[model samples]
Target: MSRPHSVVSQVPSGVLVVDKAPDMTSHDVVAIARRALGTKKIGHCGTLDPMATGLLMLVVERATKIQDLLMSEDKEYEGTLTLGVTTSTQDRQGEPLEEKEVRSFAPEEIDAAFGVFKGEFEQIPPMVSAIKKDGVPLYKLARKGQEVARDPRPVHVTKYEIRDIALPEVTFSVDCSKGFYVRTYAHDIGQHLGCGAHLSALRRVRSGKFTLERAVTIDMLKTAPREDLYKAMISLAEISLMRGA
Candidate 1:
């Protein structure tokens, strides 16, 4: 069999940080970015559910070499939690599968529960995730009307705060290790509250050293030339080499 090509052989290496717009899959953004950069060596650090938006890391050219390392970096998200409902997708993107009475809790109660999520814990990933089981994405199997037992995986929530608490809606922020699923966390928290809930919205604000403030929108990318786009891309290696202050 012929050997697979490496990203190193495709083009010069660099990383593109994009502010992925809502409703567009990470792959869709990569496709447009590939065209914008005029090269095929592009790859993304991690997968973001289409309904979620914000910073998305893209590796271009030989820099795709660092994709694995970058994907391991911790992530930060500002997500909104909508109580009183649950969904198959675990987010607003999915159909409502169940509803429960909204329970009013004091800010201290909400904060305490959120505190329970902080630190290392085992978490079951959402069935809607892109994780592959036997070479098939879990979501694909879910769409086929199949359910499978999945083992809980360890993930760390370094910081989880209830920025705002409301009976029917809660806004919060979290910083978690790679492989952590905010969607699953939201659902689990709702369950604990005795009032089922799901993620209403999610926006990743940071990944490693890359922040959402620098993300380029699709429209902005559409009008920018490959040359300009190339200039904006940052390399993961550079980010990794930086010393923490």
Candidate 2:
């Protein structure tokens, strides 16, 4: 399927908040935006794992210039942490590294573990991440059964609340600084609890001032007319207002 050449050039330059569907990479969503919005200048501010779904910010044309600034904003996510199992990728997307029987723990014990990670602390970035070493992404090395030394970096868990707990599964919400990885957080929490754990599911609810409420789904863009799609884009001026909000 191809977009009209004339329409492509005429498409507005701005940000479009997308409620990204699970199993689609951030780049995949960008490709869809290109076709639906008739613009090849589309880019996303953040990378969401294929297993993740939620608000993904796409910048078009001139809006791409502020991509770095948008990426610097804090992020909020709600996800499930599954205990008693660990994965190479720290999420459900990877092979199982280890598994253990989950022992019953008091609610306060779980709360105390959460408190240990709150505020400012250092965390080792996971091997499954896009962080690069010698210009090659770490995930590439990970896929080849290679492991390398990585230094711990600082991350702040401003808000880490347990929304619910159902034995091996714990639903939680977190608001954290830029560059924080929720996958690593889940993995570390399990280590603290003496039971292996990994991120089972994730959904980004907020990125800076952009909320899931204002996000349009891929289906919406696919089914809507070009004119209606253009109306859904957030202007550069509005993004500037997000700084104040």
Candidate 3:
């Protein structure tokens, strides 16, 4: 049975850069897009945590062909982490597993902590992540309180800068290869600082060459007319230009 407003033939196929709102899964955005655009052929290049916000690339219709290529692109993010507190999910959304006193650290000290992780390295993804184990997602096992060994995967960070430094909270920006978990980076950096920590907040600002400059909002997706959405979409020709073809 075709869903309501089924007009797959009416809309031109391309990419939509969404300025995703917090507290919603990536799938939630796609579901809304499917209804708003009145088409089922939609997918996201990357998945964002429910607590995350910012640029989320939605491949619509024929644009789904380049989803894998887009997914493999390096990513950029701005995030904050709280020191002296570690959570089960390595983020504020998770259970507070432990907490300790957060003492002051010199800027050099913090820089030294982030310095070691700037280049190529291996990172063990958080158990709450989307990684697979035995053909089942690791998050599913984490729900059952199961802990399993996971081999670390190689990752590369092109750049990172400390934006703010205050006791218990730090803001920073990072550009890294695909599959790099910013939460894990925070956790490991906490270990380097002799204080455990968890990601307090996160926002993706860029993916590959795409930025959040013209991204549409959730409200726009839900309330705007389909014609308006098509106006904001990146045409296939534009994508080809970005690819230097």
Candidate 4:
């Protein structure tokens, strides 16, 4: 027998807010949200590594229109840097290539180190990233043990504040325009300090006007009913109006 009309009519449409968990890629979240909503019109604004967590913006059905605008917006993150170690990837996932005994620094010294990174500057993205080169992803080439020169692109770090100066870790907040690579920023700063550093943990707190405050965990999203799924997704026009205004 054919399905009831009420069932077809009951599907709601909107945006979904996901508090991405550590170790789960952003694409994994989209797949789960797609199955949860029972529709194919689900998409995410930007990519986040599996090691990172916090705000991961998603759109459902009509809301998918907003992804472009959201992708171009400023981002805010709280991250921790591991000193005395340098990694190939500039993040904890990579193998450590060098280790040095680090000298602990005062808050003022930490601030000064990052002050050089703030404002507009050119940045070269790490090889183990999604950025493409000559029609192939750089990460693909990197995995094959090949290296290539990458042009530095201009990026702006509006705010780079040292929030804590714990012995081995430096916790901080970084606010930047679109296209900024916090990983490269950390690596270069480490090089400048003469102790080397790598990103240990990162959590995106804000993207444009959408904050982690409104994000729900993946588990919570997985348990939500199909009809309720689309109801949670917000539209691009809505985000544009909210962020642009």
Best candidate (score: lDDT): 3
Residue 166 displacement (Å), model 3: 1.7
lDDT of 1 by residue, 1-245 (tens): 22232333324477778998999999999898876676877899888888889999898877788788878989999999888899988888888999888857877877777887889899987888788899998999989878777889999988877878766889999999999999998988888778888998899998887797667888866667555666676654566564242
Question: For candidate 3, lDDT tens digit of each residue in 80-136?
Answer: 999998999999999998887878899899989999998899999999988899999
Evaluate model 1: give its lDDT. 0.82
| Model 3 stretches with alpha carbons more than 4 Å out | 1-9
Q: Which is better, 2 or 4, measured by lDDT? A: 2
TM-score of each: 0.91, 0.95, 0.96, 0.91
- The C-alpha stretches of model 2 lying farther than 4 A from their native spots are 1-9
Give the clashing residue pairs of candidate 3, or none. Answer: none
Residue lDDT tens for model 2, 1-245: 34333344487888889999999899999898888887788899889999999999999989988899899889999999999999999999889989999999888888898889989998899998899999999999998989898889998888888999898999999999988989999999999999989999999999988998778997886666777778888988877786773
Instruction: Report the candidate with higher TM-score, 3 versus 4.
Output: 3
Query: Model 2, residue 2: what's the lDDT?
Result: 40
Q: For model 1, what is the alpha-carbon lDDT of residue 67?
A: 88
Report lDDT per candidate: 0.82, 0.89, 0.92, 0.81
Q: Could you list the CA RMSD of all candidates, in the order they appear?
A: 5.7, 2.0, 2.7, 3.4
Best by TM-score: 3
